[model samples]
Target: MDTTACTILLVDDEAANLDLLELVLRPRGYGRLVRVADAREAVAAFEAAAPDLVLLDLHMPHRDGLAVLAELQARVPEGDFLPVLVLTADATPAARERALAAGAHDFVTKPFDRLEVLLRARNLLRTRLLHRAQRDARGAAELAAVQGRLLADEW
Candidate 1:
């Protein structure tokens, strides 16, 4: 997979965190990154970018990450996969549970290891892209079957 082809939305209320994320991802050839500092703007950014993966902060002003997750859940089409990785300072089990329940695919605490974050992001993106490929293949196969049936009917 082309790392550059995958667009990642980096959402954090803190500028430093966003910069750190960019620093971490850019070196790995993830060139298409959309950074959103305000939690309130995350949904709009998500809509505009259609990112393959999201790095979200749990606590933010205006709207919390859970709210953003809920909005994203509603916006995402059923049966489609959009990976959300929660990155926050909250390490409590309850926080993790809440985030997972709210549609986050993975959670990492703040002061996270660079390698761990990178690996998690890579894994999520891999699964998401593979799911997309499988979906597309199924659609193509279904179209072909319909075309075949139409041809048979004509004959």
Candidate 2:
């Protein structure tokens, strides 16, 4: 697999939240972090960067994380398979279910353990990278099949 270092996107409306995320993730060799202060911009960033992991905050101005997650799921198949780790203060079972239903891979409540968050982030990134490799391989195989068919027709 020709996989490179994973890229992570941290989405929240709070500057302090971004600061904390960068502080925690930077030392762990997480050098490819894309931080956005608005939840609304997540989709564009997701499309443009195709991050290996997304750390989505539950609440925000304009569009919340849940809303963004919904949009994301609609756009892609098996959308929740992308390793979405939601960060929020909502500990309610209903909220968690909503997240899970909306395609979140895991939930990390606010005031969470720093070490635990780091571990989760690393684990999710690994999963995403592997998934990406698989997807790329499948795409290449499909393209080769189509090209072979075209060449056979030409002959």
Candidate 3:
């Protein structure tokens, strides 16, 4: 974990829970961390901080994790993918399904495992970066096709 370029935007309303997560991620080599206690501020914090990954807590006061996930999905462009890890003590199948449908890249059941958290975070970040790179390549190809079409018209 060369944590040099990684930042995690952690969204958890509970102070104690937030502290526990900080302990987990820090030792795992995630040095750049921004924590927002409210779900409402997650989007703004995400954009402002520009984190490479996010660890979202499922249960919150005003807006729940599912709601926040939906918002993030709405904001991301077609080619942009954000890695969202939903942390929940609840292990119900319905909860997992909803989180996945709302755009979370993975789920972390709480009473957290030190190793699994880091592994999932790293994997999801890789997925997001790859998706963005592929999108950039597609955009470049589209631009080249348009240029070729214009050149053909001139000829």
Candidate 4:
């Protein structure tokens, strides 16, 4: 998948954070960006956009990032992958472990390094695309095998 064409959902309560993220990502060729200030809107936005990646803030009103992550995890099929990168000011080891255990593919501390964020996002997107490609290939191979068996039986 082309990074430029990939849709990314940014879920943060702070407008400034959303703006900053958009500023950093747009220049890096991430054009399809969706921003939501309320964590409550996240699941709806995600369902509507079907984004290739998600940048989720750990703390938000109404529903926390962990709750949102759980919702997303339940929504996604078992075989499908949705890379959730959790962003938070909490730099504690416990916070990081919790986020990872809650289904976050990656975590970024507050005051994130612009370069690191971009690199991580890019890497996650690449992984998602690779997984999709592998699944498609396996599906095709299975279909081919079935067709071969049917042809042999007919002969």
Q: Model 1 over residues 38-126: C-alpha lDDT tens digits? A: 98889999999999999999999999999998998789998899999999999999999999988899999999999999999999999
Q: Top model by TM-score, which number?
A: 4
Lowest summed lDDT over 10 consecutive residues: which window, candidate 1? 1-10
- lDDT tens digits, residue span 63-145, model 2: 98889988766766663357789988888888889998888999989888889889888888778777767888998999999
Q: Candidate 3 — what's its lDDT?
A: 0.84
lDDT against true structure, model 2: 0.84
Q: What C-alpha lDDT values do all the predictions have?
A: 0.93, 0.84, 0.84, 0.94
Poorly placed runs, candidate 1 (over 4 Å): none
TM-scores, one per candidate: 0.97, 0.81, 0.84, 0.98
Residue pairs in collision within model 3:
none
Ranking by lDDT: 4, 1, 3, 2
Q: Give the clashing residue pairs of candidate 1, or none.
A: none
Better of 1 and 2 by lDDT: 1
How many collisions between residues are there in candidate 2?
0
What's the residue-level lDDT of 85 in candidate 1? 98
- Model 2, TM vs. native: 0.81
Best by lDDT: 4
